[model samples]
Target: MSELKEQLKSQIIEQLNLEDLTPADIKNDSPLFGDEGLGLDSIDALEFIVLLDSFYGIKIEDPAAAREIFHSVDSMADFIESKK
Candidate 1:
């Protein structure tokens, strides 16, 4: 789980073109998309859906659930483990 979370941080940085941030810069418990967090918007949410499918081989059919699953790095990792 820890390794997956670390890899996810890297993926997020690369996928989102967040060149300025290192994996260490993103906290696992931090909100992923909001003004107080990474400040990602709706388009970034779409990117996250792609990220999950491409990297985890998991398809998210529910948009509302995606909101909860993608809420934070910790949540994403937990979701992946649950699916597995």
Candidate 2:
């Protein structure tokens, strides 16, 4: 799970073009969006969907669930493990 979280941080930075942030800068429990977090917008949400499919071979069919699944690196990791 820790490895997945670390990998997610790196992938999110590269996928979202967050050049200012390093993997260490993103906390596993930190929110991935909104004003208090990474501040990612709607379009970034689309990129996140793509990132999941391309990197992890995971597909999110339900948009509503994405809100919970993509909440943080920890949640993403948990979701991935659940699928396995």
Candidate 3:
């Protein structure tokens, strides 16, 4: 699971062109969006959907649930595991 989270962090940074951040800079439970976290906006959320589909072969069928699933690396990892 830790490995998955690390991969997620890397993929997210790359997908979003977040050149300023490192995987180490993002905590497993840290929020991935909003001013309280990485300050990511709606566009980043769409990239996340793409990332999941491209890397994990997982599709987010519900846009509404994305807020909960993409909330953090931990949540994303859990969601990936669940889909598997």
Q: Could you give the C-alpha RMSD of every candidate to the true structure, in order shown? A: 0.9, 1.1, 1.0
* Winner on TM-score (2 vs 3): 3
Write down the lDDT that model 1 would get.
0.92
The Cα local distance difference test for each model comes to 0.92, 0.86, 0.88
Judging by TM-score against the true structure, name the best candidate. Answer: 1
lDDT of 2 by residue, 1-84 (tens): 898889988999999998889999888888888986788767788888999999989898876568888888898899889988
lDDT-based ranking:
1, 3, 2
Tens-place lDDT per residue, model 3, 1-84, is 898888989998899998889999999998888997798877888899899999989888776669888898899999999999
Superior candidate under lDDT, 1 versus 3: 1
lDDT of 1 by residue, 36-75 (tens): 6899887898889999999989997876568988899999
Model 2 clash number: 0
Q: Which candidate leads the pack in lDDT?
A: 1
TM-score of 2: 0.92
